[model samples]
Target: MAKITFIEHNGTEHVVEVANGLTVMEAARDNNVPGIEADCGGACACSTCHVYLHPDWVEKVPAKDAMEEDMLDFAYQPDEVRSRLTCQIKVTDDLDGLIVQLPEKQI
Candidate 1:
Protein backbone atom coordinates (compact mmCIF):
# COMPACT_ATOMS: atom_id res chain seq x y z
CA MET A 1 0.00 0.00 0.00
CA ALA A 2 1.03 3.58 -0.61
CA LYS A 3 0.28 6.59 1.54
CA ILE A 4 -1.56 9.41 -0.24
CA THR A 5 -2.01 12.80 1.32
CA PHE A 6 -4.91 14.92 0.10
CA ILE A 7 -5.08 18.55 1.08
CA GLU A 8 -8.20 20.65 0.80
CA HIS A 9 -8.33 24.22 -0.49
CA ASN A 10 -8.81 25.29 3.10
CA GLY A 11 -5.71 23.41 4.22
CA THR A 12 -7.44 20.40 5.75
CA GLU A 13 -5.52 17.20 5.16
CA HIS A 14 -6.78 13.66 4.71
CA VAL A 15 -4.07 11.07 4.56
CA VAL A 16 -4.93 7.52 3.66
CA GLU A 17 -3.23 4.27 2.74
CA VAL A 18 -4.24 3.09 -0.73
CA ALA A 19 -3.42 -0.25 -2.23
CA ASN A 20 -1.46 -0.45 -5.44
CA GLY A 21 -3.44 -0.50 -8.70
CA LEU A 22 -6.20 1.69 -7.25
CA THR A 23 -6.64 5.25 -8.50
CA VAL A 24 -6.30 8.29 -6.29
CA MET A 25 -10.00 8.97 -6.70
CA GLU A 26 -10.74 5.53 -5.30
CA ALA A 27 -8.65 6.27 -2.27
CA ALA A 28 -10.61 9.48 -1.62
CA ARG A 29 -13.97 7.77 -2.07
CA ASP A 30 -12.98 4.79 0.08
CA ASN A 31 -11.67 7.11 2.76
CA ASN A 32 -14.47 9.69 2.46
CA VAL A 33 -12.10 12.50 1.62
CA PRO A 34 -14.14 15.56 0.69
CA GLY A 35 -13.76 17.38 -2.67
CA ILE A 36 -13.30 14.31 -4.81
CA GLU A 37 -16.60 13.79 -6.63
CA ALA A 38 -15.34 11.22 -9.13
CA ASP A 39 -18.49 11.77 -11.18
CA CYS A 40 -17.34 9.60 -14.05
CA GLY A 41 -15.98 6.81 -11.84
CA GLY A 42 -12.34 6.96 -12.96
CA ALA A 43 -13.14 6.66 -16.63
CA CYS A 44 -11.38 9.95 -17.45
CA ALA A 45 -14.72 11.25 -18.70
CA CYS A 46 -15.09 14.01 -16.13
CA SER A 47 -12.92 16.40 -14.21
CA THR A 48 -14.67 16.37 -10.89
CA CYS A 49 -11.66 14.61 -9.44
CA HIS A 50 -9.24 17.39 -10.32
CA VAL A 51 -6.16 17.80 -8.16
CA TYR A 52 -2.72 19.39 -8.21
CA LEU A 53 0.38 17.32 -7.67
CA HIS A 54 3.13 18.69 -5.49
CA PRO A 55 6.16 19.97 -7.38
CA ASP A 56 8.21 17.09 -6.04
CA TRP A 57 5.75 14.63 -7.55
CA VAL A 58 4.86 16.44 -10.75
CA GLU A 59 7.46 14.62 -12.78
CA LYS A 60 7.17 11.43 -10.77
CA VAL A 61 3.61 10.92 -12.01
CA PRO A 62 3.08 10.03 -15.61
CA ALA A 63 1.99 12.66 -18.10
CA LYS A 64 -1.67 12.95 -18.95
CA ASP A 65 -3.05 11.24 -22.01
CA ALA A 66 -5.03 12.89 -24.81
CA MET A 67 -8.39 11.95 -23.35
CA GLU A 68 -7.40 12.98 -19.85
CA GLU A 69 -6.06 16.30 -21.10
CA ASP A 70 -9.28 16.98 -22.98
CA MET A 71 -11.42 16.12 -19.99
CA LEU A 72 -9.37 18.46 -17.85
CA ASP A 73 -10.85 21.37 -19.79
CA PHE A 74 -13.98 20.80 -17.74
CA ALA A 75 -12.13 20.94 -14.45
CA TYR A 76 -12.93 23.68 -11.97
CA GLN A 77 -10.16 26.25 -11.68
CA PRO A 78 -7.96 24.29 -14.00
CA ASP A 79 -4.20 24.74 -13.93
CA GLU A 80 -2.37 24.07 -17.13
CA VAL A 81 0.64 22.57 -15.44
CA ARG A 82 -0.80 21.30 -12.19
CA SER A 83 -4.29 20.16 -13.04
CA ARG A 84 -4.96 16.43 -13.18
CA LEU A 85 -7.93 14.15 -12.82
CA THR A 86 -7.22 12.01 -9.80
CA CYS A 87 -8.92 9.07 -11.48
CA GLN A 88 -6.09 8.83 -13.98
CA ILE A 89 -3.47 8.58 -11.30
CA LYS A 90 -3.00 4.93 -10.47
CA VAL A 91 -1.49 4.17 -7.11
CA THR A 92 1.89 2.41 -7.11
CA ASP A 93 4.58 1.52 -4.62
CA ASP A 94 6.72 4.28 -6.09
CA LEU A 95 3.96 6.80 -5.38
CA ASP A 96 4.09 6.32 -1.65
CA GLY A 97 3.67 9.61 0.23
CA LEU A 98 2.10 11.26 -2.79
CA ILE A 99 0.66 14.68 -2.07
CA VAL A 100 -2.42 15.88 -3.95
CA GLN A 101 -3.98 19.27 -3.42
CA LEU A 102 -7.70 19.61 -4.04
CA PRO A 103 -9.26 22.41 -6.03
CA GLU A 104 -11.78 24.82 -4.54
CA LYS A 105 -14.57 23.43 -6.65
CA GLN A 106 -15.58 19.99 -7.92
CA ILE A 107 -18.92 20.71 -9.53
Candidate 2:
Protein backbone atom coordinates (compact mmCIF):
# COMPACT_ATOMS: atom_id res chain seq x y z
CA MET A 1 0.00 0.00 0.00
CA ALA A 2 0.96 3.60 -0.55
CA LYS A 3 0.57 6.34 1.98
CA ILE A 4 -0.82 9.31 0.05
CA THR A 5 -1.37 12.79 1.32
CA PHE A 6 -4.11 15.06 0.01
CA ILE A 7 -3.75 18.73 0.80
CA GLU A 8 -6.58 21.21 0.52
CA HIS A 9 -6.10 24.68 -0.93
CA ASN A 10 -6.40 26.05 2.58
CA GLY A 11 -3.66 23.63 3.73
CA THR A 12 -5.75 20.95 5.43
CA GLU A 13 -4.16 17.58 4.80
CA HIS A 14 -5.62 14.09 4.69
CA VAL A 15 -3.23 11.18 4.69
CA VAL A 16 -4.39 7.69 3.86
CA GLU A 17 -2.98 4.30 3.04
CA VAL A 18 -4.14 3.10 -0.36
CA ALA A 19 -3.63 -0.36 -1.69
CA ASN A 20 -2.06 -1.14 -5.03
CA GLY A 21 -4.25 -1.47 -8.14
CA LEU A 22 -6.35 1.47 -6.97
CA THR A 23 -6.24 4.98 -8.25
CA VAL A 24 -5.35 7.97 -6.11
CA MET A 25 -8.92 9.15 -6.65
CA GLU A 26 -10.15 6.04 -4.91
CA ALA A 27 -7.99 6.86 -1.91
CA ALA A 28 -9.57 10.30 -1.64
CA ARG A 29 -13.11 9.06 -2.16
CA ASP A 30 -12.79 6.13 0.23
CA ASN A 31 -11.10 8.24 2.88
CA ASN A 32 -13.55 11.11 2.38
CA VAL A 33 -10.78 13.55 1.63
CA PRO A 34 -12.34 16.87 0.84
CA GLY A 35 -11.69 18.70 -2.47
CA ILE A 36 -11.56 15.85 -4.95
CA GLU A 37 -15.11 15.76 -6.29
CA ALA A 38 -14.40 12.87 -8.69
CA ASP A 39 -17.61 13.80 -10.50
CA CYS A 40 -17.13 11.15 -13.13
CA GLY A 41 -15.86 8.53 -10.73
CA GLY A 42 -12.69 6.99 -12.15
CA ALA A 43 -13.76 7.16 -15.76
CA CYS A 44 -11.65 10.19 -16.64
CA ALA A 45 -14.80 11.84 -17.96
CA CYS A 46 -14.41 14.99 -15.84
CA SER A 47 -11.74 17.20 -14.28
CA THR A 48 -13.29 17.51 -10.84
CA CYS A 49 -10.58 15.25 -9.38
CA HIS A 50 -7.78 17.58 -10.39
CA VAL A 51 -4.75 18.04 -8.18
CA TYR A 52 -1.24 19.49 -8.16
CA LEU A 53 1.70 17.19 -7.53
CA HIS A 54 4.25 18.11 -4.93
CA PRO A 55 7.40 19.39 -6.64
CA ASP A 56 9.44 16.57 -5.18
CA TRP A 57 7.23 14.06 -6.88
CA VAL A 58 6.79 15.72 -10.25
CA GLU A 59 8.82 13.12 -12.13
CA LYS A 60 8.18 10.24 -9.78
CA VAL A 61 4.58 9.72 -10.89
CA PRO A 62 3.51 8.44 -14.24
CA ALA A 63 3.28 10.82 -17.15
CA LYS A 64 -0.08 12.00 -18.42
CA ASP A 65 -1.60 10.44 -21.51
CA ALA A 66 -3.28 12.34 -24.34
CA MET A 67 -6.75 11.93 -22.83
CA GLU A 68 -5.69 13.04 -19.37
CA GLU A 69 -3.84 16.00 -20.85
CA ASP A 70 -6.98 17.05 -22.66
CA MET A 71 -9.18 16.57 -19.62
CA LEU A 72 -6.93 18.81 -17.57
CA ASP A 73 -8.04 21.73 -19.70
CA PHE A 74 -11.35 21.67 -17.89
CA ALA A 75 -9.80 21.80 -14.41
CA TYR A 76 -9.91 25.02 -12.41
CA GLN A 77 -6.76 27.18 -12.69
CA PRO A 78 -4.72 24.27 -13.98
CA ASP A 79 -0.98 24.55 -13.67
CA GLU A 80 0.65 23.50 -16.92
CA VAL A 81 3.41 21.72 -15.03
CA ARG A 82 1.75 20.35 -11.92
CA SER A 83 -1.90 19.68 -12.77
CA ARG A 84 -3.08 16.07 -12.93
CA LEU A 85 -6.27 14.04 -12.59
CA THR A 86 -6.04 11.83 -9.52
CA CYS A 87 -7.94 9.10 -11.33
CA GLN A 88 -5.11 8.86 -13.82
CA ILE A 89 -2.64 7.97 -11.07
CA LYS A 90 -2.66 4.45 -9.75
CA VAL A 91 -1.34 3.53 -6.32
CA THR A 92 1.82 1.43 -5.90
CA ASP A 93 4.72 0.87 -3.54
CA ASP A 94 6.66 3.47 -5.49
CA LEU A 95 4.03 6.06 -4.64
CA ASP A 96 4.33 5.76 -0.89
CA GLY A 97 4.17 9.20 0.71
CA LEU A 98 2.71 10.72 -2.44
CA ILE A 99 1.41 14.22 -1.89
CA VAL A 100 -1.05 16.31 -3.91
CA GLN A 101 -2.72 19.66 -3.43
CA LEU A 102 -6.30 20.37 -4.44
CA PRO A 103 -7.35 23.39 -6.41
CA GLU A 104 -9.22 26.23 -4.74
CA LYS A 105 -12.30 24.88 -6.51
CA GLN A 106 -13.00 22.21 -9.06
CA ILE A 107 -14.53 23.01 -12.41
Candidate 3:
Protein backbone atom coordinates (compact mmCIF):
# COMPACT_ATOMS: atom_id res chain seq x y z
CA MET A 1 0.00 0.00 0.00
CA ALA A 2 1.03 3.57 -0.60
CA LYS A 3 0.47 6.35 1.92
CA ILE A 4 -1.19 9.39 0.37
CA THR A 5 -1.73 12.70 2.14
CA PHE A 6 -4.46 15.09 1.07
CA ILE A 7 -4.74 18.67 2.25
CA GLU A 8 -7.81 20.80 1.89
CA HIS A 9 -7.82 24.42 0.85
CA ASN A 10 -8.01 25.57 4.45
CA GLY A 11 -5.32 23.17 5.65
CA THR A 12 -7.35 20.13 6.63
CA GLU A 13 -5.12 17.10 6.22
CA HIS A 14 -6.16 13.53 5.54
CA VAL A 15 -3.75 10.66 5.21
CA VAL A 16 -4.64 7.25 3.85
CA GLU A 17 -2.81 4.07 3.00
CA VAL A 18 -4.04 3.23 -0.48
CA ALA A 19 -3.87 -0.11 -2.20
CA ASN A 20 -1.75 -0.55 -5.26
CA GLY A 21 -3.49 0.20 -8.60
CA LEU A 22 -6.13 2.44 -7.01
CA THR A 23 -6.36 6.02 -8.15
CA VAL A 24 -5.64 8.92 -5.80
CA MET A 25 -9.26 10.02 -6.26
CA GLU A 26 -10.34 6.64 -4.92
CA ALA A 27 -8.11 7.08 -1.93
CA ALA A 28 -9.67 10.47 -1.14
CA ARG A 29 -13.22 9.30 -1.73
CA ASP A 30 -12.65 6.20 0.38
CA ASN A 31 -11.17 8.26 3.19
CA ASN A 32 -13.77 11.05 3.09
CA VAL A 33 -11.32 13.79 2.33
CA PRO A 34 -13.15 17.01 1.55
CA GLY A 35 -12.91 18.83 -1.80
CA ILE A 36 -12.47 15.86 -4.10
CA GLU A 37 -15.90 15.53 -5.64
CA ALA A 38 -14.83 13.08 -8.37
CA ASP A 39 -18.04 13.62 -10.33
CA CYS A 40 -16.95 11.25 -13.07
CA GLY A 41 -15.63 8.63 -10.74
CA GLY A 42 -12.20 7.51 -11.99
CA ALA A 43 -12.89 8.16 -15.61
CA CYS A 44 -10.82 11.34 -15.90
CA ALA A 45 -13.73 12.92 -17.70
CA CYS A 46 -14.30 15.72 -15.20
CA SER A 47 -12.42 18.32 -13.20
CA THR A 48 -14.09 17.70 -9.87
CA CYS A 49 -11.17 15.65 -8.70
CA HIS A 50 -8.62 18.31 -9.44
CA VAL A 51 -5.72 18.78 -7.04
CA TYR A 52 -2.34 20.41 -6.92
CA LEU A 53 0.81 18.62 -5.99
CA HIS A 54 2.50 20.27 -3.04
CA PRO A 55 5.42 22.29 -4.32
CA ASP A 56 7.85 19.90 -2.67
CA TRP A 57 6.17 17.01 -4.41
CA VAL A 58 5.70 18.55 -7.86
CA GLU A 59 8.31 16.37 -9.49
CA LYS A 60 7.41 13.08 -7.85
CA VAL A 61 4.18 12.37 -9.75
CA PRO A 62 4.16 11.46 -13.39
CA ALA A 63 3.41 14.00 -16.08
CA LYS A 64 -0.18 14.59 -17.08
CA ASP A 65 -1.55 13.29 -20.36
CA ALA A 66 -3.29 15.38 -23.01
CA MET A 67 -6.72 14.36 -21.80
CA GLU A 68 -5.95 15.36 -18.24
CA GLU A 69 -4.60 18.67 -19.43
CA ASP A 70 -7.73 19.32 -21.40
CA MET A 71 -10.00 18.41 -18.53
CA LEU A 72 -8.02 20.67 -16.20
CA ASP A 73 -9.27 23.65 -18.16
CA PHE A 74 -12.54 23.22 -16.33
CA ALA A 75 -11.02 22.93 -12.88
CA TYR A 76 -11.79 25.38 -10.10
CA GLN A 77 -8.43 27.09 -10.08
CA PRO A 78 -5.82 25.32 -12.11
CA ASP A 79 -2.08 25.83 -11.82
CA GLU A 80 -0.32 25.02 -15.01
CA VAL A 81 2.57 23.32 -13.30
CA ARG A 82 0.95 22.01 -10.13
CA SER A 83 -2.57 21.01 -11.12
CA ARG A 84 -3.53 17.38 -11.71
CA LEU A 85 -6.59 15.20 -12.00
CA THR A 86 -6.36 12.78 -9.09
CA CYS A 87 -8.16 10.09 -11.08
CA GLN A 88 -5.21 10.06 -13.42
CA ILE A 89 -2.77 9.45 -10.63
CA LYS A 90 -2.72 5.76 -9.85
CA VAL A 91 -1.27 4.72 -6.51
CA THR A 92 2.08 2.93 -6.60
CA ASP A 93 5.16 2.24 -4.51
CA ASP A 94 6.96 5.19 -6.04
CA LEU A 95 4.32 7.55 -4.66
CA ASP A 96 4.07 6.06 -1.20
CA GLY A 97 4.24 9.40 0.57
CA LEU A 98 2.55 11.49 -2.10
CA ILE A 99 0.94 14.70 -0.97
CA VAL A 100 -1.70 16.75 -2.81
CA GLN A 101 -3.64 19.89 -1.95
CA LEU A 102 -7.27 20.27 -2.81
CA PRO A 103 -8.47 23.20 -4.81
CA GLU A 104 -10.53 25.96 -3.18
CA LYS A 105 -13.59 24.48 -4.83
CA GLN A 106 -14.62 21.51 -6.98
CA ILE A 107 -17.47 22.61 -9.15
Give the alpha-carbon lDDT of every model. 0.92, 0.95, 0.92
The candidate that achieves the highest TM-score relative to the unseen native structure: 2
Instruction: Compose the digit string of candidate 3's lDDT tens values, residues 1-107.
Output: 99999989899899899999999999999998989999898898889999999898888888999999999999988999999999999898999999899988997
Q: How accurate is candidate 1 locally (lDDT)?
A: 0.92
What alpha-carbon RMSD in Å does predicted model 1 have with respect to the real structure? 0.7
lDDT of 3 at 40: 92
Pull out the clashing pairs in model 1: none
Question: In model 1, where is the ten-residue run with the lowest total lDDT?
Answer: 72-81
Clashes of 3: 0
100: Cα error in model 2, Å: 0.3
Return the TM-score for each candidate structure. 0.97, 0.98, 0.96
| Candidate 2 per-residue C-alpha lDDT over 46-65 given as tens digits, one digit per residue, 9 for 90 to 100 | 99999999999999999999
| CA displacement after TM-score superposition, residue 37 of candidate 3 (Å) | 0.5
- Model 3 weakest 10-residue run by lDDT: 54-63
Query: Model 1 TM-score?
Result: 0.97
lDDT of 2 at 89: 97
Regions of model 3 farther than 4 Å from truth: none
Q: Answer with 1 or 2, whichever has the higher TM-score.
A: 2
In candidate 2, stretches whose alpha carbon ends up further than 4 angstroms from where it belongs are none
